[model samples]
Target: MLAVAATWSRLAAMEFDHVIIGGGSAGCVLAARLSEDPHVSVCLIEAGGGGDDIFIRAPALIPAMISGRPRINNYAFLTTPQPGLNGRRGFQPRGRALGGSSAINAMLYVRGHPRDYDEWADLGAEGWSWADVRPWFLQLEGNGRGGDDWHGGGGPVQISDQSAPRRISRAFVEACAEAQIPRNDDFNGPEQAGAGLFQVKQFRQGQRKGERCSAAAAYLFPALGRANLTVLTRTRAERVLIEAGRAAGVLVRRNGRRRKIAARGEVILSGGAFNSPQMLLLSGIGPEDELAAHGIAPVHVLPGVGQNLQDHLNYTILHRSRRRDVVGLNPRGLVRLGRAAGKWRKTGEGLFATPYAEAGAFVHSRPGLDRPDLQLHFVIGIEDDHMRRLHLADGYSCHVCALRPQSRGSVGLVSRNPADPPRIDPAFLSHPEDLATLMRGARIMERVLGAQALAPWRGGRLYPHDGSDAALAADIRARADSIYHPVGTCRMGRDEMAVVDPQLRVRGLQGLRVVDASVMPRVIGGNTGAPAMMIGERAAAMIAGAGGDGGAKAIP
Candidate 1:
């Protein structure tokens, strides 16, 4: 053990041109793109094992990783008790491996409404307008449907149509259409307000077709053989080593030993919403009062380091399924799943390739809305409380979430300990407007589920409630939680409260940047995985262009 520790300590002394703190969605992209130059050395540090497990690759096995029992590749962190949720602490499951949440998410490839980015530009995030960021989205997408005005043909992340969607999923889309929501085959196309099956982040062709196309699979693994890139897994970054007010390196722990990994060019934090802001606070680069309270000497005073936390608060309307084809914990369902697993092993086309929330829609909760304020995810299983609470009967669920929530929460330090989980407070539905919008969305979903298209499969409504506004409001408060899209904790803007500039460089500090969903000024209207990757693509361009010496450098 001493010899092994000595070898690791010596390897840690080696400096790299760029050292990324989190090997997540954006970190994988950054490592791949930055190392493309071949002259610059890049090191990616991940706190979990390599994300190449069979459970991660198989889309249908998502529950195995997400379920916190065995805690496969999931961080499975829980948020502080939310007042809006009747003081119930919501479950916050983030991927702990190289691909990050993208490795364990439902695999939906949603790019959000264009106006989400336009709003960011309007809010002082310069160069982040819809027109400016669209190209980056296109550049990173490899859609199986081929490139058009809104998509790219060949890129790192593969996007494909669901290989074999369940019949119930199709019925859900039809029911949405029957309830007056128009059918939209392509949600990522010109309009996002409609119902249809979702395109997933999965391989569409080749031997790995139908497998989850996580960031590690699409970007990092392909670049692993590059001489300039080094990936260190199960390595925890303790704090950023700031020297003379410029970020110099990171103090990390591996195998219970501490070592400093020098960053000759820049240090990037892509630790998603929770960990990214935690990293800033741990380094004494956040609110002065918070840092002082934790007994950590202040390195930089950025009051907005962990503020403006936002997430999509979702409420579900569940119904027991009359048919046996849907996913459940019954004997018949398990037998079917066993057979499906066998088929998946032979050919990557079966129930095993399913991204459970197969079909969904985006619709306005009321008239006069410019864009879809509500998003619905039609799950083919009975997902009660992030699938932690299981039911014996087969059922289906429809999740209704307010896309642009007005509520804002925060992430804060517990004791300046990197090992300790940060206090996460998404404060879902804290705003009166958010609650009202979600209530309206729930009514809409109830109607869609009642439509004739789903009647054949829909059984008695689970947790049946009287059709009253007051009853619906109570249900929402009691059961609402996040759909796993957390963002904006380390928001980027030119305002005083901004942690990073529009170029993603941490304000009031040099040689440090944040390139993850946490830097979003506002959470988008859809899943955050694709947008997080886009941020990485845009940051790589900014770093390459700003580097006058042909190596990565902090932009002034």
Candidate 2:
């Protein structure tokens, strides 16, 4: 295996010690960290192309990135009709290239609450409690505040506040304080509940010509100089090749051509939550009955392979200000765009900045809970007039989401072909508890909206404020959408629902690991980008024994 690795290193060709499935957040981090050792060959496969487009680099141009002709920034997918949402179909957007969702999502650098992973460790995913993962977070980040025991100074990923975009961002923080929520210094710090400007995964590309750097732009770019890394974009993994129930290789397709390659050591699936489980199910590793339906022999009848689907449920309150002044996205909105360009040219600081999701917080809706049951993610501007579809009028939206939902769904195969999208049912509002939390969440949204600070921006009731809990229950049923934080499916635990062990190895297959959000025992409390990136960092070190102290860090 070492000789082959050397041969491949010299030839700059196949046979990798680690084959990462997706070149998104997790895969990119793994590829960069693992390939640092030229002795080990690393292969990263991305179904999407490299993100060189200008829209991807700009923090404010995210929607335009997703709604373009090529749609190169995203892998657009539609879920099977969700029965819980009145059988309404939902849209699933996964990032296509180097940064994945980090490439397309509104750049919000939130690191959820510490209690989330602590609970995961308590639930069964050992060595994964907050204490174990926090170091990796600090390791990958070059925080704006510089290095502390909690953060690193010279990491590849650049994390800072939008330079000139701080005005509106500060306004967001002031409004949160005026509302009596008490400003919390850092969402990524000890406590998670409160409103403050969010940290962003942004960098000063240059005075004008630099591409706004992203995770892939940071982690993957530095590693590109290494000889051991071979990154193939637009090459999608068809299935994991299992030889006698042990992982051996993978089948991938590019430009209508199919090819096979062997993994001398391990085949790691970092395809996030949705595609990871879908690929596993397509490879005959899901429930026995589902595999039989597709006429494929079951490799392992893991009933939970695609089960336990969950995501943050969001409620948007749309308001039309009486001042006739557009908060965002109007003819006068060119000011925002103008600022982005001017700052991009002058100081690498402006609206091109990441004020997209500047202020946010976590809170327990009804109170008396052990932790915050809901998280508030407030954006000051209005991007799309409506939800999922185009808007009929001018308005700004404030979104509140139920953080830790009890509702569960599943992902399954639509057909035997891996090219086709798998059936995903996020099944939002499926449980009564989830419904109650979200309804209370709507009340919290109103409280924040009606605060004295918002008096200057207050308008008539925007979307729905008059509905009763029963009526709001129906309204929530009508329009509660996903903030796009999906997880579980390939859950990590010791129970039957667990598809991977605490070490993250596939239960029935040797040399195979699911090292992405798919293995999360449950979704974390905030945006998943940080947690997912941290997972990649830890997993790569574990696989290669390459980091500080070869021993796994213990959770506090």
Candidate 3:
């Protein structure tokens, strides 16, 4: 009886011209860009609270922030048991706030290799080639190093050099050079096959210094005062209210009440890979057999709604650092951090201002590969089990992950309940080639660690102390897990399994689109945040009746 009453209440409605579900990384960008035309009313819904928490703003607090209580801003999801990792369930930490995972991420501003976008174009995501999307990437960036042919100026998201990187990070880069990897200053430059320090998506000037420039901070917060834009936070969107095979509005739950907010223009799903596919499935738009099994009348039979799940599975090589100054957890390092915090509070320039994974490398597993197949994240602290285990001593770690995994999985509905979390099975390491590539990458990591530059600080190996390939492979199978890059659930392509087309419009559906990491045909070579934002920028241009020229251009 109560269910029927709630259903009736959910039917009570309001309307907007553009309703964007999920005020996340992509949603924030869409809302800001769409609301630029004041004539059009835009609504953005988020499942979490404001992104103004101090923990989220501080770059050094990312590790502590993600593990904090209330979990209002962090959807600390756990993956299903993977046969790859010896049946161990991996931890998936996705941000629930306005900025989404960008709020909780390491703030690395890696745009991935250009070949990654070229591959997307080849895979049927037309107009998304490296040349086509390069301008869009420039259009969204407000780089601190000024404008160039490859970068932009006066954009929203600020990409700045690390304010203060640890000496160990420098050593990691030098060590990579010693290991035969070239030192490339800019990973987003003409080439992406080397090692260097990473830039961050953070401000380097004015009042926003020493703070993260999340999507909420960069795009949504500034656009909040606009009358045409309505940002409803702490509200969960249940499902898209599709009427007569067309998306009409979204039914959302807030303050113990359900209301339908109609979309006159289009309903865009920006809820990411996990939530977006779940939303579509809940709306009866997934596999017909699965919907019937869950007692749902199918609205659209899209077999690939939650298919093609891909992620970068990484294994860490930990070593106790001989120097306390090189790591963050030791007593000496803690004192330095305490002093750095005071300096950051005053001048916004200190050790506390930089994300710890400051330096990394992208290398090919073999000689014939056109681009890098392996990526390395060198951290100045032990990050085993996602930092759940804290060692009292000084230590550093290197994480190696296969850039492109052939393994695929699925996200499915356990039941018809909208509040229930979806079953995420990222069948990590299902392919033999993926594990083999990771094993090869692990050997490269060992080589990097053994380089002359890192020898002074490197102590005894804390993980898999053995130096043989057989032992390393055993350790990889026991511990390899996700590095937080999950994508390709609602793949965009011309294939029959594709959920969305190249225009980001959902196939076999009208008045609907999906603009997020979920629409990625395949996972990119680097981080997903920058690419996800690029998708948002391009999606907004498409919706505004413009082609690919809607964003703030470079000032020539």
Candidate 4:
């Protein structure tokens, strides 16, 4: 390892006001926001190349981006065999590009339930309540719905309605209504209950048409010309350099060369939950025993560095359909896709403009719950095993997840090498209550699919093999997996085990902070991308000394 003095000398010629590790969703936002000051120099380092492929820009190619082996833009990590999942190893596909998962995700723009943020406040993350964080959400969103108390009209991120929603998609929402679930025009509105179509991160009203608005597109690319900001792609951060109890710099590797980048103001880790905690542990900031086992000397024995891992585990229910227009793997669907592509090239308004899971719902497992515990994603295509398998028949699938899982897992170091993937253990369904909730959700979804509103599309049940709750439970244990949302590894709180404090600063360190999904005290009740970007916005305000922190000094 390079000594602090040596590292400082090497980077003396090019020190930055803020060195942000990981040019993912949070890092891009931070780099964009902080460089706006003009006086503060910002550096953003990304492990993957600039995510600018045509496939990345198209909203309909999400399956191709996320469903496969590790590629140039994907970090396909496999979890340790999950006991809760019947010894099945879960496949996790995190974006390895500049925009992170935002570049590859389905582009749903959900803010999650307001109660999620309020619960963060209750769990020692003061000033993170729905009331406190709502403004930040508005500040980051350029919602096509126009500026309202619930949304903003002019911001970096574009929130728009689906361009060419399928008739089957509308039927799913109507089916939910037939099953007694109310129709919600806006999931981010006053309440989160009910079923509706999801708004996405695509261009709503522009010549750009149906292009995706990822974090890089929304925040990073527009700010590229700013002299104060420097973004380095395909550079992997190896460790955080701490000297005399303060974060001084970062050790990184690019093009097979190791170098240190000094941060004059602060070193912020914007890596997502999996990577952020792994970086901490690799840099000797985790549990003493774990570090010693890896032959790493502990710098800060924060046992909570990789603990409290939580993710939304979901199971999908597939049904066959007789409709020929519906997308599938058959020759007719391929021909339709080709025609859609051609139409997209000209009009940008066709079947190619929509994301796969076009509609969704949030409902309770039982009556009188404070909030909905179950979430649904209605896909217009059959997405079995993350679309790794292409079903020949035209069909649709419904993904149901227990919004807030009770099981807690961890991400740990497999080796000292930064290039090696971290050990992930989401421990899906370890908690009995989680399984019960999922079973209830599956039952509720069955009713919705069976509703008369879907008679035109529904053919026959093709999943779980049987409807018995016992068989469903067994199938869940066998087939349940992540919906791609993982958080809470480096949870923010005031407890002794909390990795970061309410201000998002590492509790036992100075001049260092974590501003990503890892700092969530608990995973939000909806998709995590929007919440992750919201955290980035909030972090920028705190760093610029212009936001609330519940009395904690946010900046060094």
Candidate 5:
């Protein structure tokens, strides 16, 4: 373990078998798995503090950590103004600590529909079909419900049902069922089109039960006792050093001093959707024209280095609740919260253990669709503008997002300096089809909230709309933004636009690969945290030449 504030006069030059940039969700998995052989050395570098604080471990403090005002453990990056969003800039809050976004997220453990991976294989991502990748997902999960054909038990990543979901959350699920959406106990099972409580990436048993089990807590921290692994926090990678057409090392800066760390084997970038592509462009491995425009000498000309950006654009519907059980800023709610905190500390179960977005549903926006095209999240409290805005009255919110959008965007350089944030443009709702689907979804959600199952709790709709297409379309354009699932900037495929190959290796480059959500051929139907870790697990096997098809064996 190392800190940036420590003196590094004696650590001028260091070498490792593998040098991984961005100590995030996937990077933690890579560092832990690759260093298990004992003979191999791994170095993991992160630009944030260690992710073991109470703000991250406690499940209910999500709003505090996700706030942009103080920027707790979040990057809180703002996207470029989207013409599709009435020219309003969207908020993109990414985690900046060891566990990455998983540490600050709502901890929903979603695997997406199986066909999502099948689509990846269809898009020239060979050896990544549903059947081929199922083992990897099973191998990474430690489900509290025990192992079944669809889930795994005793794995590194802990998953559990919400300890004590709020009453309004249950009411929302019931309302979904009343609206004709079937009740599903497990979204990762045979069927995905239904409503139920979402399983979270949290400890299910033992002393840490109900706590957030981020990738760093599940993998990296457990492997820290290994002598061959070195974890460096608050260290930023400026660029990758390419010598003789091969990735040789990374130049990093810590505490204002720059150092060169050589990689004897490989250099992996796991900086999520935005930073991974930005790193490639900074290393002069992107388009020739973009490089020249930035005053950078192009080393590799991969035109797709930062293209194909996709995300789930979400619009939330809120209602003031007549019931006091839902979370709120009112006096009665605050008193309940104080008592719940004490109970949580004593028993690891209470209101403080809530993940907030406790219940959700997957449903098709219209008739005749084979699978669900819209996903919904039920929040226990009123949330607007990513929770940046607060409400004093007791209320609840339901978030609806199109499962797969057709719009494409890109991540580009603002300057050659690595310190500058990437220029992000999700280009949300640019396609007419996306807007159509969201309109249908919004109508469906309104019906569900109006169902008799939620009549006891429903108070007043926060954002009311006249029943008309134009009103709904205008509301969508004004309020819709990202649900924080951004992917496909450094897309993986065999096409000319693919940034990385099927094996996750950078096209036309050696000893370098991208193993994060950025390499996703398309964004999945749900959250990106679990899929990102699965990518790391599969990539480790491929890099180590272990399983022939990159299938991970269950860890005993």
Candidate 6:
């Protein structure tokens, strides 16, 4: 209950040209891009501790950074009851550090689908079509694939092929070929409708600890020397300060003490999808009735501030192998462990480098489908989606995800308290079209497993088939959920409910804007990380009044 304005005088000095809140993926990009000006002072505030851990930096060491595992690096936020999932409270694990989820995620670099952004432009987010966003994606990626019209060559983030491939990994790609699905050299390439290798964030040295080039390591670390940028770690933003009509500052807390940061140019909330809207609601910028119920007066009644929440719903299928498969334990983990240690100690090789999924593809459930409706990730371990954990059995698993569902959900405040988790109702299966598409994807998976080549290798179903369309549909509806990509809250549009305009500015507020996944009008057809970074990269150019070059050269 501290007064936000009362604490401003006791805190650190005056205004910054830009105050970027939540130094995660988008915030780090903004800080890096804007500070290139060397004139406009920028202040970046992150609630979590420094993202400086060896385990997080290593691409392979990422899975080891688990939450609720005592020393894991993440914030465990429980969701309000989800009415759609039989009143279940979902576990939303968000990173609490500089690079954000990019530091702790699986590091799979996916650009999603071109049509995904086309939907954005179609929804009145002008200049957000596939053509407009394609350049931004190219600007940030330094893939080993070399410079293409589609991808950049010498960008900060290194998108390269994984160092080592699991034995079964190569077979998965062959399996796709046997099933009539083509093999693609790149998922981010012109055609995204085939199975191939997925590009990852990796260094030439391979899975070395503390060397994973995350956004902070890639963009912000190099930009930190700029005198115009100030990075404040462990500072949690409580709410945005919208005085009269413009967003002037933010109410923040550090070391159990409160403070305020007033922004002269803009208070940009790059807190991503979950937090951007959550922060907005806490600052009395949401639906009229919701704000009034919390005893806070709404400054601008933006009904769509926390609406249009969307995420990919996926179900994994696991099968036992006929031979010493990817999941097949050598019966002596001690021997395998000894060999892996030997390899790493000698040639700097072994299982420590990669964990399958070295190859996969996005495919249509059937021919003539406009886009690839299913995305498959072939893991070496037996991962059961329904249980949300690895299986006890020794077998490899395949995660067949429904790329785009017709379902729509929402993320909104359950109470006035910012600490309280929001109610996330991603009403899956509520839409008939979503159910049909997912079922179709499931059938496609069945076809892949039923392929003649895989017939000899296929074992008993780990997720047993119910056989009935009604029953299979029920299993999918109950189990399939997010691939950790949640977006579109505080969606951008021209409608009355739109929270942000085409320029990513707040509809009714000045000096405040959101440049993150929260501005997506709909969930993209693929993973959202690449596109979210592009938004930050492109938005930086617009805000700086410079053309779309981040070359760090002097402005003409």
Please give the CA lDDT of all the candidate structures. 0.89, 0.74, 0.86, 0.87, 0.89, 0.73
Model 2, span 1-556: residue lDDT tens: 0011122224445678888898888888889988988898888888877755667776667766654334657776777777767777776677887778888887677777787899999999888888888888988887878887767777777778656443434555666676667788677876778877777787744432224556687788667767778877778799999887777888988778777868988888989888998888878888999999989888877888889888987877766654433345565666656655776655666556554666776777876777677777666555432223544334456778888888998888889998888888888877878888887888877777777666665666545545677777777767767778989988888887788877778876778888888888888889998888888898888888764333222211
Error of 5 at 88 (Å): 0.5
Taking the tens digit of each residue's C-alpha lDDT, what string does model 5 give over 1-556?
A: 3232223566434899899998788999999999998998998989888888888988888998787778998999999999999999999999999999999999999999999999999999988898988999999999989998999997899999888998878888889988999999899999999999999998877877778899999999888888788888888999999988788999999989899989988899999999999999999999888889899999989899889999999988999998889899889889998898888877889899999999999999888877799999999999888888888999899999998899999999999999999999999988889999898899999989999988988898887889799988999899999999999999999988998887888888888889999999999888889999999999999988885433222111
Ten contiguous residues minimizing lDDT sum, candidate 5: 547-556
Candidate 3, which segments miss by more than 4 Å at Cα? 1-13, 68-72, 330-332, 548-556
Instruction: Write down the worst ten-residue block by lDDT for model 6.
Output: 1-10
Per-candidate TM-score against the hidden true structure: 0.97, 0.91, 0.95, 0.96, 0.97, 0.90
- List candidate 4 segments past 4 Å from native: 1-13, 70-72, 549-556
lDDT of 1 at 543: 82
lDDT of 5: 0.89
What is the TM-score of candidate 6?
0.90
Which residue pairs clash within candidate 6?
none
Q: State the lDDT of candidate 6 residue by residue for 1-556, as single tens digits.
A: 1011213334356579899998777889999999998778898888776776656654445444544344366765555555555565665556677888777766678888888788789889888899998888888988877998888988888887776676577777778888889889888878889887788765544444214566777688777777787888777788989876877899888767776788888889988778888889889888887788778778777888778878777776778876444544345533564565556545445665553456677988767877787888877666553234644455677777777767777777777776666667766656777777777777777767667656556677875866789878767756665567778888888888788877788877778889888898987767777777888898899789764422222111
Off by over 4 Å in 6: 1-14, 66-71, 205-211, 322-349, 385-390, 452-458, 548-556
Count of backbone clashes, every candidate in sequence:
0, 1, 0, 0, 0, 0
- The 10 consecutive residues of candidate 4 with the worst lDDT sum are 1-10
Off by over 4 Å in 1: 1-13, 546-556
Candidate 3 C-alpha lDDT tens digits along 480-545: 788889999998988899998887888888888899999999899999999999999988988887
> What's model 5's TM-score?
0.97
Question: Native-vs-model 3 lDDT?
Answer: 0.86
Q: Model 2 off-target regions past 4 Å?
A: 1-12, 66-70, 166-169, 205-213, 322-327, 335-339, 383-388, 391-395, 546-556
lDDT of 1: 0.89
* Candidate with more favorable, higher lDDT: 2 or 4: 4
